[model samples]
Every structure is written in structure tokens, then in C-alpha cells.
Target: MFIGGLGRSGTTLLERLLGEVPGVAPLGEVVHLWERGVIGKEPCGCGEPFTTCPFWRRVGIRAFGGWSTGLADRILTLRRRVDRTRHIPALAARRCRVGLSGYTRAYSRVYEAAAQVAGGRVVVDSSKHASLAFCLRTSPVVDMSVVHVVRDPRAVAYSWRKQITRPEDGTPMTRWPSAWTAVHWLVQNLAFELLARRGGTVIRVRYEDLLADPPAVMQALLTRLGLGGVAVTFLRQGVAELSVAHTCAGNPMRFAAGPLDLSRDDNWCDRQPRLHRWLVTALTWPLMLQYGYRPRDRRTPEGAVAPWLTAGVAAQECR
Candidate 1:
């Protein structure tokens, strides 16, 4: 399964919760693994360098006959060539398949290898990039389902301005200004909506709903995916039981394990700059309302119905 959303939109949190599900294997962000995990030798979720981690080592061997600086470099170059947000338009045309063959094959190999390494558990890739999602759509070998997670634009914009540190490397995580985030947020979400209109199973979920009632959200997802037998015992009483897995690059929270407090992080309401919030809402008003986010009600009242297409969500979970 692929989790699609903008950065800092709770994709990591959803993936971590899904990791605890039986018959599921979480691969943090394979879209970044070629560079961050393989070339840069960043820490995996297990807290070991990807080159030294047994899980990734096996994946490399299975995927490409073993890891080497040369192979990593080659794939990284291919990734940049074919996988990019701007390339989504061409990829959607589906006529670029011939040119994208190399990366498509490489990507399929990574998931295949991961599935093999994880004893055939379903691989959950929380890459959270609309461009990457479209790239994967071109691959015949990858059977992907999308969990399109949406959050309030104001909250998402506020998140982009905060300083965060990467747990994988000692470097700081990427941060974007509110305007930049607003534009990308609109584009990314629209891309996913376009993707659903084209093909494949795409289930939409509000990030607020997921944070508020993880058990219900996760159970609804599993049941929709026909994995109704899997128990979501890991989430209960507003806490999530996280386990170490070989996730690649993601939010620093990916490094966290054991019991984690699943409180709603709504720091944006009061802390965000009024100018930034207004700009974000103005830039994204039309689609924002389509997603059920109120333009005036920037402050999502505590315990109120999550601002989203709840009926659309219910239809998806049932289907």
C-alpha cells in the first residue's frame, strides 16, 4: 500500500500504527531510501545504518544482487531523472512508460525484495509523494493501493514552518514557508484526487479523524482492504504500541517505539502567524472546502466532527 500526502501531514504516524498490524511490513520512504538510506547511509528504523542493517542488506541482495556504492549511485540518478513532482503531468499521460522503464523496474524490485525479506508481509510504503505515487502507477509489477491522508491546510502550513531535526542523520529536516507549503499542498492533494479519477483503489482519510480515534480509522482501513481478520490491538486508550521496523526515511517519530501518546497536535491554531494562515486558506479555499475544511473555522473545535467528507469516507470504507 502507498500512503500519499504532503510532508508533515501525519503519514508517518499512520504508517507506524499500520506497522503493528499483523501481516504488514512498513518501509518508511523508499522514494528517499535510494539516497538517504543507501547512498547517505542514514539510520533505519532499527537504529542501524542501512548498509549495516540486516534487513536492508537482505533487501539489497534480493533486489539487486547486493548493495554497492556504484549501484546506489546509479539508482539515485535514475530516481532523479524519472521520479519528480513536476514529472507527474507527463507520467499521467502514460506515454512516458518506455523512458521510465528502468526506474519502474528498480522500484518494483525494491517492493518485491522487501516483500520477500519480510516473509511476504504486505509492504506499507509511506513515501507520501504524489509524484512518486504516479510513478508507481506506471509499473505493471507493483499492485498498489493508496491511503490518501488529508489534513487541514492551515495546520499543514503551520507544521511546515516549525524546525525539526532528523533522527536518521543529525541534520535538520526540510522546512517550507507557508506560501510554498500552500501551493504544494494544493497541487499534491489535487494530484491524488486526479489519480483516483483515473484508476486503482484510493481510500481517503482525514488526519484529524485518524489522530482522534486511531482504532476506528485503522480498523476501517483494514476492513476496506479486505484484511478484516487483522486485529488492531496496538492502538487503544489514545496510545499506540509501536514496534521497530526497517522503515527508511520519514518523520523523526519513525524512530520512536513502545507506547506513544497519540494526542492531537494542533499547535497551528494559536501559534501560526495570522498572515500565513490567511494566505494558506485563500490560496486553497476552493478545494479546501471540497475536502470539508471550513474557510472561516480555521480553528477545528475540539471533539467536533472532523472537517472532511465523512460520507465519502464511509462509502470508501464500506466498499
Candidate 2:
């Protein structure tokens, strides 16, 4: 299954939670697998850098005969040309052209190899890019299902505005303005919706709802993906057990060991500037309402009702 959404919308956390299930292998962000993980030699979830990790070494051998920096760089270049918000419409329309099919086949090899190494029936890829998700959906090498993860735009904007350090490298990641982040939230969500309508098997999940009830949300998600028999265990309240996931690249949080706390990050509600909060809400209003996020004045005591829950959409599980 592919986890598609805007970054920082809880894709990493969801990947970790899903990875806990017996037959699921969470490959952090395979969009970055060739570039950041392989070429840049960034650290894998296993602590060792990607090129040095035994699991990745095995995957490299299986997928590409051997991992080569030159080959990785070429693939990264091809990925850059095809995977973009502007190219999403062409991809969804199934407009086959030069370079598109090659990228898809190359990308599919990573997931196919991951499944081989993980020994799992399902591989969870939290790539979080709509264009890439569409590409995977079109690929013949792997059967892909998409989980479109959405968070409140206000919360997402606030998270993007804050300074965050990559846990793997201790490098400070860049932050975008509230306005830009809001626009991204809108476009990315719409793109995923468009892809779903174009025959991709997609199920949307709200980050807040997932945090409120992980097992229940996951049960609904797994059921929709037709893996209803898979078991997911939470070690305690708000904590999930994590194994050694050989994910290529993602939030540094993927490197965290032991049980993970599955709590919601609502710091934006209390700390975001008034102007920024209003801006995000105004820009995201229509789609927000469609997804069960009400205007501040109209919010219910129980908070937002996910679209899947209230609209009788596919994979309804929120309560």
C-alpha cells in the first residue's frame, strides 16, 4: 500500500503504526530512496547509512543487480522530470510519453525488492507525493493501493512553519510560509482525490481521527485494503511497538526505537499566530468542510468528523 499525502500530515507515524502489523513492511519514502538514501547515502531507519545497511544492500542487489551512484543519480533525474504537481494531470490521464514508463518500472523495483526482503505480503510506502502515487498506481509490476492521509490545514500549516531537525542527520529542515503551505495542502489533497477518481484504490484517513483511535482506524483501513485478517497491536495507551524497519528516507522519527507514542500534535492550536491561523482556514475552507472540518465557530464538541465517516465515503470508520 502507498501512503499518499502532503508531508508532516502524519504519514510517518501512520507508516510506523502500519509497519507493526505482521505482513506489512514500512519503506519510509521510496521517492527519496534513489536520491537521498542511495546517492546521498543518508541514514536508514536501521541507524546505519543506506548504502551500508545490510537490508538495503540485499535490496540493491535484488532490485538493480547492485546499487550504483551513477544509476541512482540518473533515476533521480528521471523522477524529477516526471513527478511534480504540474505533471499530475498528464499522469492521471494516462498520457504515456518518453521517460514516464521507465521511471515507473524503476520505482516499482524498489517496492518489489522491499517485499522480498521484508517477507511481508504488503509493503507500506510513505512517499507522500501524489504524482508518484499515481505513477505507482499505473505500474504493472506491483499492485498498489493508496491511503490518502489528510490533517487539518490549520494544523498542517503550523507544523510546516516551525523549525524541525531531521533526526537522522541532525540537519535543520526548511520551513515554508503559512500561505504556501496552505496552497500545498489544497493542491496535494485535490490531486490525490483526482487520482482516486481515475480508478486507483484509495481510502482517506484523517490524522486526528487516527491518533484518537489507532487500532480502530487501522482496522478500517486494513479492511478496505482487503487485509482485514492482519493483526495490529498497540503496546499500551498511545504507544505502538516498532520493529527494525529498513526504510530508505523519511522523517527522522522513523529512526526512533522502542514503542512510539501515537499522540496528536495540536501545538498549532495554542501557538500559531492569529493571522496565520485565519489565513489557513480561509484558504482551506471549502475542502475542509467537505472533509468534515468545520469553521472555528461551527465546530462540534467532538471536533471534526472525517468525510469518510459523515459522507458515507469508502472505508468509513470514524465515530
Candidate 3:
């Protein structure tokens, strides 16, 4: 299963929760496997550096004969060139260049190896990139399903505007302007919706709903994935069982050890600047409505509801 969404939208938390299920391996952000895991040698969920992780070492050998900086660079370059929103049209047309095909094969190998290592049937990738999900959907070797995660745009904007330090590395996470964050949240979610309509199964999960009831939400998701009978071992509130996972790259939260409290981070709803909140809600109003988010009570100059847009027009504008 591919987890596609904007960063800081609880993809890491969801991945950690899902990883607790039997016969499932949650590989955090495999899209960055090449650059961060192989080249930069970041720490794995296993606490060892990515290069030295026994599980990843086996996966490396299986996926690429052995990982190398040169191979990592090549993969990263290929990804940058083709795996992007602007390149979606060509990819959708099945314009499979050699590099693109090679990358698909390599990625499939990584997933296959991960499944083998975990002794599991399902390989979960929380890449959170719509383009990567699109690319994987086109791969002959991959039968991809997507869980499109979304949080309130205001929350997403607030999260992006903060300067959080990575737990694996003390480097500060990149922050974005509230406007850009809102724009990206709108475009990326729309893109995932369009891609989902094209092929394969896609399920939308709201961050709030998931946090509200993780067990029910997770069970429903696993059922949709045809794993209804698989024992779900992690569901208790304020407790999540974790195991060593060969995740490639993701938020520093991936490195967190032991049981984790499944709590909501709705602090943004209260602490976010009113202007930023208003801006995100306005920019993402139509899509937010589609996703069941309520509009603010504020009115426009014309005494009409603020930021109103017809759903049809919103879909068209997104396209």
C-alpha cells in the first residue's frame, strides 16, 4: 500500500500504527531510500545507521547487488527528472523511458525485498508523494493501493510554518509559507484524487477521524486492503507496539522508540495565526468542503459566505 499525502500530515504516525499489524512492513518514505538511506546514511528505525542495518543490508543486496553512492545518485536523479506533478501526463500516457522503467524495477525490488525480510505479505510505503504513488501505479511489477491522508489545511499550514528539529538528525525541518502550504495541500490532494480515479483502489483518511478512533479506522483500512482477517496487534489508546522496520526515510518520529501515545496534535487549531488559518481555509475551501470540513462563519465583503466555490469549478480549476 502507498501512503500519499503532504508532509507533517501524520503519515509517519499512521505508518507506525499500521506497522504493528501482522504480515505488514511499513517502510517510511521509500521515495527517499536512495538519497537519504544510501547516500546520506541516515539512521533506520532499527537505531543503526541505514548502511549498517542488517535488514536494509540484505534489502540492498537483493535490490541493487549492494547499495552505493553512485547508484543512489542515479536513482535520485531519475526520480527528480520523472517523478513530479508536471511529468504526470507523460507517465499516465505510458511513456516508459529506460530510466523510468529502471527506477520502477529498482523500487519494486526494494519492496519485494522488504516483504521477504519482514516475512510479510504486504509492504506499506509512506512516501507521501502523489507523483511517486502515480509512478508506482504504472509499474508492471507493483500492484499499488493508495491511502490518501489529509489533515485540515490550517493544521498543515501551521505545522509547516513551525521549525521542528529532526530526531534522527538535529537538522531543522524545512518550513513553508502558509500560502504555499495551502496551495500544495490543495494541489496534491486533488492530484491524488485524480490519480485514484484513473486506476487502483484509493481510500481517503482524515487525520482527525483517524486520531479520534484509530482501531476502527485501521481495521476498516486493513479490510479494504483485503487483510480483514490478519490480526491487528496495535489498537490500544496511548499505546502502539513497534518492531524493527527497514524504513528508508521520513519524519524523525520514525526513530521514536517504544510505545507511542496515539494522540491528536490539534494544537494548531488554537495556536495558528488567525490570518494563516483564514488564508488556508479560503484557498482550500472547496476541496475542504468535499472532504467534509466546515467553512468558517466569516463573511465576504458581499455579505456572502467567504471563499465559496462550486465543486465543479473547483475540480476544473484544480485540473
What's the CA RMSD for each of the models? 2.2, 2.6, 6.3
lDDT by residue for model 2 (1-319), tens: 8898998899998898888888888988988888788778998999899999999999889999989988888888888788777888888888855687888888778788888987988898899999888777667777888888988888888889889898766889879999999999999999988987787777888888787767667776776777776667654677887777888888878887787887778788788888998998999999988776776943222334444633222433321
- Lowest summed lDDT window (length 10), candidate 1: 310-319
Q: In model 1, what lDDT does residue 310 have?
A: 38
Please identify model 1 stretches exceeding 4 Å from their true place: 302-319
Best by TM-score: 1
lDDT agreement of model 3 with the native? 0.78
- Candidate 2 residue 229 Cα shift, in angstroms, is 2.4
Deviation (Å) of 25 in candidate 3:
0.8
Give one digit per residue, the lDDT tens place, for model 3 in 1-319.
8888898888888888788888889888898888888888998888889999998999888877899999988888888777888877676666755578777878899999889888999899999888887788778889888888888788889899889998777889899999999999998998888886676567777777677666666766776677776656666655677666667788877877677787778777678888888888889999988876776733111212111122111122121
Off by over 4 Å in 3: 297-319
Point to the candidate with the largest lDDT.
Answer: 1
Q: How high a TM-score does candidate 3 get?
A: 0.90
